[model samples]
Target: MGESLFTKVWNMHKVKTLSSGQDQLFIGLHLIHEVTSPQAFAMLKERGVKVLHPERTFATVDHIVPTKNRQRPFQDELAEKMLAALESNTTDYKISFFNLSTAYQGIVHIIGPELGLTQPGMTIACGDSHTATHGAFGAIAFGIGTSQVRDILATQTMAMNKSKVRRINVSGKLQKGVYAKDVILKIIEVLGVKGGIGYAYEYGGEVIENFTMEERMTVCNMSIEGGARFGYINPDQKTFDYLKGRKFAPQGEAFNRAIRFWKSLASDPDTHYDDVVNIDVSDMAPMITWGIHPGHALEVSKSIPALNRFSVDEKATAQKALEHMQLKEGQSLLGQKISVAFIGSCTNGRISDLREAAQFIKGKKVHKDVFAFVVPGSVQVKKQAEEEGLDKIFEAAGFSWRGAGCSICLGMNDDQLVGDQVCASSSNRNYIGRQGSPTGRTLLMSPAMVAAAAVKGELVDLREVI
Candidate 1:
C-alpha cells in the first residue's frame, strides 16, 4: 500500500524507537517566541546543557508585544522581561533572533514561511499551539510544551507517538461570499471539536487545491482548534512557486535538486488513509461562531440552535454560551450589535486578507460607534500592505492601522475588548477571556465579513454589503 504524506515525512525524520514505545524524531526546525521560551531556557540553564543545533533554531517576539506605541521597555513589565530573556538567550546561544528592529520581526509563524525557513519534508516544532500553520507547506509541524522545548533545545529530538492520518477532502468550488475561514469553520462544526483527536489531517480535493497559499495557511492554522495535533496539504506547483527566490530557499542548481525532492515528498496517487471525510463546499456560506468554542458555530444565515437540538450533556454548555453572548436560542445572529471589529492574526493577517478587506471597505466608513483596526502579520507583510496602499484604505475607513504583532488574538497584549462588548473578529479562538475581558464576546469570521460588521456595526452578510 502507498503511504500518505504524513507517513513519508514522519518516517524520514524518525531517529529511533524509544523503550516507551514512542519515536525519537529529529526536528528540522525549532521556532520559539517570547511567552513560552523563558522557562525552557531556564531549564536548560539548570541542566547546564547547550543547544545541540542552534543554527536550526529561530526566535522572535510576538505574543506579548504591544501592537501600538511599541517603545522600548514595554508598558507590561512581565512582557518586557520575557522579551529581554529571549534576547539574552538567543544572543548567548547563537540562535537567529528576529527582534522588533529587524525587518523579519513579526509572528513566528508568519516570518518562518516568508523567509523560506518552513519547507516541505521537514519536521517543525514551536512553543506555540498554532505551529501547525507551517503544515501548509507539507511539513509535519506541531506545538510543544516548555519541557518539550527544553528537550529539543538540549538534544534536537523529541519523543512523539505516531498518529493516524485522516484524509479531509473538500470538493466543489466555494460560493462568492464564502472564504477559507468559512470552510474551516464549517469543517470544525461538522467534525466536532474532539473528532480529530489523535490524528493528523491531510487536506485535499478541488477546494483546497485551488486555494492560495495564504488561504491554505489559514485553514491549517486552525488544525489545533479542531483537536488535531497537525494538518498538511501536499506540495505542488503553487508551493514551489511561493518558495522560489525566498531568502532561505535554495539557489541555482541546488534549487532544481530541492524541487525534485519536494515533489517526491507528495503522497502517492493511491495513498491510503486510516479514514476519509468528504465535504462539498459548493453550497457552503460564510460562517461565524455563536458560542465560545470554535465548534459552536453556524452559517451566517442560520439561527442559534435551540437547546433541545443539542445532546443532553451539551445543553448546559450551550445555555452558558447563550448567557455569556447575550444571545437567544432560535435567534439569527444577523443585526447583532458589535462594538469592535478586528482584522489581524496569524490566521488571517496576510497580504491577501488585507487586500480583500481593503477592496471591500474602500468606499465605506466604519460605523460611528464601532472601533475597528487592522494589523499585518509581519513587518514584511506590513511593508507590502503599505506599498499596495491597503493601510491608507483602512485608515480612511476609520480602521486603526497598527504595527505587526499577535494583537487581540489573545489576552496577552494591550489590544483587547472592554466590558461585555461584542466584537466581530477575523482572529481565531472565541473562548471566554480570549480577548482580554472575561465578559468580552468574540464572533470569529472572515476578514471581509469582519469588514462588513465594522461598517454596519452589526452582524450582516458580506454578500449583501458587496
Candidate 2:
C-alpha cells in the first residue's frame, strides 16, 4: 500500500518520540496574530527564553482591528495593547511583522499563502483555530493553544498525536449557483459535527481536483468545524502555479527544484486511508446554517430539522439551537428576513471570494432594512479588489466597503452585529454569540449568497437571484 500525504508530512517533521506517546514534531512555519500571541510572548519573557526559530515565524495584526477607523490608539485600549505587544515582540525577536503601514498586512491566514510561506510537505502552526486554513497547501497545519504557542516559540517543536486519515471524495460537478463554501457546509452537515473527531480529512475527487487554489483554501479552512484536526488536498499543478510567483516562494531555477519536491509529496494513487467517505454534489444546493452550529445546515429550500427528526442524542442540542435562533422546527429558511449581511473572513475573504460577491451584487442595491458590508481578508486583497473596482460595486450597492481585517467574522474587532439581528454571513462559524452580540444570530452562507440576501433582505436561493 502507498502512504498518505498525512503520514509522509508527519514522518518528515518528526523530531523524536516523547515519553508521553506524542511525537515531538518540528513546525516548518509559525504564524502569529495580535489576539493570541501576546500571552505567549509574555510567557516567553517570563521564562527568559528567546524564540527558537524567529526566521521561520511571521506576525501580523487582524483580530481586534477596527476596520472603519484604523487611526492610532485604537478606541479599544485592549486592542491597541495587544497590537503593540505583537509589534514589540516581533521587532525584538527579529521576526517579520506585517503592520498596518505595510500593504502586505492582512489576516494571518490570508497572508501566509499569498506570500508563499505556506507550502506543500510542511508543518504549520498558529494560535488561531482556523490555522487549518493553511492545510490547503498540503501541509500539516493545525491550531495550537497559548501554551502550545509558547512551546513552538521556545523550542520550534511541539508534542502531538497523529490522526487517522480519512479520504473524502466529492464527485460530480457543482451547479452554477453552488460554491466551495456550500460544498464544505454540505460535508459538515452530512458527516455531523463530531464525525471527524480522530481523523485527518483528505478531500479529493472530480470536484475538488478541479477547484482553484482559493476554492481549495475555502474547503480546507473549515476542517475544524467537522471535528477534523487537519484537512488538505494533495499538491498538484494548481498548487504549484499558485505559489510560483508568491513573494516568499523560490525564484528562477530554485522554483523548479521546489516544485520537484512538492510534487513528490502528493498522495499516491493507492494510498491507504483508515476510512473513506463519498458525497455527490450534482444535486447539491447552496447551503445555509439555520441552527447554532455548522452542522445544523440544510438546503435553502428544505425546512429546518424538526425535533422528531433528530435522534435522541441530538434532541437537546437541536432544541437549544432552535430556541436561541428563535426559529421553529419544520420551517424553511427561505424568505427568512435578515437584518445584516457580512462578506469577509479567513474562510471567504480572499480576492476570488470578493470577486464572486462583487460580480453578483454589481448594479444591485442593498435592501432598505438591511445593513451590509464587505471586508477583505487582507490589505493586498483589498487593493486587488479596488483595482478591479469591486469595492465600488459593493459601495454602490449600499454595502459598506471596509478595510481589511477579521471584521465581523469572529467579532473581536469593533465590527459586530446589534441585538437580535439575523445576519447573512460569509464567515465560517454560525454559533450563537459568534458575531459578538450574545443575542445575534448568524446564518452562514457563501459570499454570493450573502450578496443576494443583502439585495433582497431575505434568505433567497442564489439560483433565483443570479
Clashes of 1: 0
lDDT of 1 by residue, 304-354 (tens): 988999988678989999999988999999999999999999999999999
Per-candidate TM equals 0.99, 0.99
**Top candidate (lDDT):** 1
Tell me the lDDT of model 2 at 314.
81
Per-residue lDDT for 1-466 in model 2, tens only? Answer: 8999999999999999999999999999999998888889899999999998999999999988899999998999989988888888998999999999998999999999999999999899999888888888899999889999899999999999999999999999899889999999999999988998999999999999999999999999999999998999999999999998889999999999999999889898989899999999999889999988999988887899779999997889999999999999999999999999999999999999999999999899999999999999999999999999999999999999998899888899888888999999999998889999999999999999999999999999998877
Give candidate 1's TM-score: 0.99
Query: Which 10 successive residues of model 2 have the least lDDT summed?
Result: 297-306
For model 1 the local lDDT of residue 92 reads 92
Q: Which stretches of candidate 2 lie over 4 Å from their true place?
A: none
